[model samples]
Target: MKKVVFKVGGSILQELPESFYKLLIELKEKKVCDPVIVHGGGPEINQALEQMQIESTFIDGLRVTTEEVLEVAQMVMCGAINKRIVSLFQNQNGKAIGLSGVDGKLLQAKPIKDGKLGFVGEVTKVETAWIDMILQAGGIPVISPIAAGEGETHLNINGDTAAGAVAEALGCRLVLISNIPGVMETIDQKEIIHHHLTKEEVEALIDSGVIYGGMIPKVRSALASLQGGVEESVILNGLEPGDILKYLDGEKVGTILSEKEVVEHV
Candidate 1:
């Protein structure tokens, strides 16, 4: 079965509509795609940290994960958020198994930023055979971004980075779903999302300051996914009804980020 890795942002999870999940079931039933979900829980983590009176910080879109913060992150991501997604799938009549990178050594990693980022990790390796096993059994894998090291060490990975790595490992499509619609730019003095973006075009936008902040990592991950042999990469809003199917059908629904603009198949 063809695979697609979906990276769902924390900000959108709480409001995910049932119809969004119905599309996943449709894809599975129709044999259109096998979907894997990698999720983030930044908002919930922040709230939990605040409630516990623990300080939090981020540098360049990566959470500066101190040991204390990592504890909070693991709880919110692996415990709360992961099961929420799994329950949603079950309620939608889809069989989903929630997992962490630590499970079955699916993802292996080492500390990044010379340990300055504490437990933040760069994905060194991804094992997709087990993921394929789940897919073969007609089960969707709902993954949290928390990873484990050699022993007694858990690493927090960026959701987009994790998703991109999974897509690269599977050599499949990558769909980056967020609350916002897509990558935006000012055209004719009116803000509009670029339907298709090339490397050069995206670079120019970054240089011109049209793309900055959180979007930098997102677009960069898309470029990285394409370079890593992912079939296609797109950034689109998950809340939009039927947008996922429309994008997969190549109907120009969202911002298509690519090394080059390839013709859509359907």
Candidate 2:
């Protein structure tokens, strides 16, 4: 079966309708694509931290994970949010198994920036067989981004990077689901979707400040997924779940990234 990895950000996870979950169930049952989901819990984590009287911050889409914050992140990402998604699937009669990177040693990691970002980690390696097992059993694997660290430690990883690493390891397709349409360009004061982008063009836009905020790591992750052996990487709006069908059906749906220039479609 062909594999497809999805990175669903926390911002949209809560707002997603039942229709989205149904589509996923339909796709999996039909064997359209073996879907592996890597999800983020930024907003949820922040809410939890604030309620617990802990401060949380982010740098370039990656949460600056302090030991205290890491505790909350794990709690929210692995405990609450993960189970919630699983329950949602069960509610819809869909099959899903929620697991953390620490589970089955799925994601191995090392500290990013010499531990300057505290417990923030960069994915050093991804173990795909664990995920493959779940998929082969006909269950979607809902993964949390917290990774296994050296000797009884755990690290918080960027969601997009985690998804990219998984895609690379599995050598599959990756679709980063977000709230927006895709990478946007402000041409003549109008936000225009790039429709398609190359790494060079994405970098140029980033350097020119067209791509900033959370989008920086998102595009970079898409690029990484492409370089990491993914057959295709795209940024798609989860609001329109039907677009996923369009994309899987080989129709243009979102911003498809490329390493080399490709002719743009109207």
Candidate 3:
């Protein structure tokens, strides 16, 4: 069976409908594919930091983790957000195990940029055996992106990056669940979603200014994961009901980013 790693951000966690959880349960019950979720807790962490009077900062979509920030991040991602997701799945009658990269050494890492980001590290390794165990046990693994670094240090990881690593390690597809439908371009006065895009095509679109602003980072991140051995990175709207299922069912519901060339949607 195939496995699909989902990267869900905290910004959309509350907005995800019950139908989404139900769909996940349905997929598991039907043995469609093993669905693994790697989640972020950015907004929640920010809120907690504010309550504790700590400044929140980021560099290129990655949080700058000070010692205090890491503490709060751990509490939020591993404690609150993690359990909440597990509870949601359990509420839907789906068995789920919430975990952090620190749990079972699922993800091992080291400091990046000479610790310029301060406890923010990139995943150097992903232990896929634990994830396989959970999948074999008929349970979904909801992972928080807190990685175990050298010594006793715990590091904060990017949700997308973590999910990409997991997908690459498992040789599975990476589905990035976000608010937007996909990469859109106005053609003939109508907004159209590009169903598929290659790395070069994405760059051309960015140069043409069709892809700009917030989407730039998202698409670039997806493309970067392609270079990291991920077969495809899918960007779709989690807010839209059935978009994920539609894509899974072979309907054109999102933008698929791959290194290879493909027919572009016109």
Candidate 4:
């Protein structure tokens, strides 16, 4: 069976309803594409850091991880948020295992940006044997974005990048599950979502200033996954949980991006 990596952000986690988990369970139980999750914990981390009187600094959208910040992030991502996701699945009678990149050296890495962002790393390797084991055993693996770094050090990884890496390693489709409906464009004075886009189309949109700011990184990351050998990348709305199934059914519910200009729904 094919696999799909669902990348979810921390900000939208609480907004996801139980029906979403139930859909995931149905996907697993029905022998559809194997659904794996890589999640973020930004809001929870911010709350934890604030309670501890710690400040967060960001450079180019990445958190500058000091030693203390790393501890709190690790605690929140691996411990609290991870288990909460697992429990959500279990609550719906689904088998789900929560893991961090540190576990079993799942994601081995080294620091990026010349170490300017302390303890922030990129994935150099992904050991997918255990992930396959979990999938074969009929369980969903929910991963947190924390990489094991050199010589007993742990590094923070951006969740989208982490998901892209996993999709690359597994040679699978990557679904970016976010709050927004999809890439929107004003056509005929009506805001309409572009259900399909190629790299050239995306670039044209970018040039026309249709895709700007915050969304640039998102679309770029999706394109990067295609370059890294992922089959396809989709921008999906987590709020409309049913859209996932719609996309899978080739109903054009969200934006499907491809390297080539050809439009293939499924």
Candidate 5:
């Protein structure tokens, strides 16, 4: 059976509607493919941290997860967001299981070297066995991006990185659903980049400052997945109902990335 990894960001998770759930049900009913969802809950985590009066910081788009912020991250990512997504699938007549990096030693990581950013992690290992078991049982596994490292160290990993690692490990296609349609050539909202991009092209866009800030990490993660041997990686607007199916059907639904492709002009 084919497998696909869907990386749902905190923004989309918070805004997901009934239509999205219906679409998931459709996918399951059709047996389109086995899906593993890796999720992040940054907004919710930030809210919880604010409530607890813990100041959060970021360095190079990665959250500087201090001890206090890490507590809130664990609570929001594992306790709330993970379970909520699982319940959504269950409500839609689909079997869903919630998991974390700590579960079954699924994800292990090492500390990232941003000295100012406290406990951020870069994924070192991803075990696909548990995820496969859940898929074999006809259930979706919802993963939270908190990894346990050597010793008593638990690190907060970037959601995109975690998702990419999981996809690479499973050799599955990676689909990242974000609020935007896809990458764009211009800052103009209408100029959506709908074609596949090569690594060189991606680098040029970044160097030209067309891609900046938050998009950098996301695009990099997608590239990493492709380089790691995933067949394809796509970035699409999650708000659009049935967009996932559209993309899977070979329709031009988003920005696709892969190695250089030979194009023939007739």
Candidate 6:
């Protein structure tokens, strides 16, 4: 059976609806493909931190996770968000299991720059065996981004990068579900970039500042996933019903990223 990794960001988690869950159920019922879900809860974590009167900071688009903020991030991402998604999948008649980077050492990491970002980690390894066990048990594994560190430490990993590592480790295709439809040619709200781009093209866009701010990290993550041996990677709007399945079915639902065009160039 083919496997695909779907990484849903906090933005989509906040807006996910029953219809979306139903679509996932339909995919399972049809045996379209085996899917493993990895997710983030940025906004929720930030809200919790704010309530605690803790200030948050970011460097290079990655959260500068101080210990206090790291606690909030763990509670929100693993405790709240992970369970909610698992429940939704189960409600849709899909067997789903929630996991964290800490589960069975599923994801191992080291601090990105030690004291620079406090608890922020760069994923060093992923144990795909545990994920395969969950899949074999007919469960969709839902992973949260908090990872336990080596000896008396805890690390906060970027959800997108974590998902990419998981996909690469499993040798599976990756679908990065986000708020936007896909990469845009212009920054205009309606300008959907419908064509596939080479690495050079993506670099040109980055150099031109057409892709800046939050988009820079996301695009870079997608590129990294492609280079890491995943067959393909796509960035699509998850709020739309059936968007992910549509993309998987060879429909032009989002911006697709790959090393080279497998299908007729479109």
Please, what is the whole-model Cα lDDT of each candidate in the order they appear?
0.86, 0.87, 0.89, 0.91, 0.82, 0.82
| Candidate 1 per-residue C-alpha lDDT over 226-254 given as tens digits, one digit per residue, 9 for 90 to 100 | 88778788988888848888887768778
Give me the runs in candidate 4 sitting further than 4 Å from their true place.
Answer: 263-266
Per-candidate Cα RMSD to the true structure, in Å, reads: 2.0, 2.9, 2.6, 1.6, 3.2, 2.7
Give every collision pair in model 4: none
Error of 2 at 258 (Å): 1.8
Cα displacement (angstroms), candidate 6, residue 95, comes to 1.5
The residue pairs in collision within model 1 are none
Worst 10 residues of 3 by lDDT: 257-266
- Candidate 5 per-residue lDDT, tens place, 107-158, comes to 9998888536777888889888899898888788899999988887888988
Residue pairs in candidate 6 whose N, alpha carbon or C atoms collide under 3 angstroms: none
Q: Which ten residues in a row are the worst by lDDT in model 5?
A: 257-266
Compared with the true structure, model 2 gives a TM-score of 0.90
The per-residue C-alpha lDDT of model 2 at residue 157 equals 91
Number of the candidate with higher TM-score, 3 or 4: 4
What C-alpha lDDT does candidate 5 achieve relative to the native structure? 0.82
Model 6 lDDT on a 0 to 1 scale = 0.82
Regions of model 2 farther than 4 Å from truth: 56-63, 185-192, 207-212, 261-266
Ranking by TM-score: 4, 3, 1, 2, 6, 5
Please give each candidate's TM-score. Answer: 0.92, 0.90, 0.94, 0.94, 0.89, 0.89
> What ranges in model 6 sit over 4 Å off?
57-62, 186-192, 262-266
Q: Give the TM-score of candidate 3.
A: 0.94
Q: What is the lDDT of residue 252 in candidate 5?
A: 74
State the lDDT of candidate 3 residue by residue for 129-185, as single tens digits.
999999999999999999999889999998888888899999888998888899999
- Model with the higher lDDT, candidate 1 or 6: 1
**Per-residue CA lDDT of candidate 4, range 155-174, in tens?**
99988889999999998889
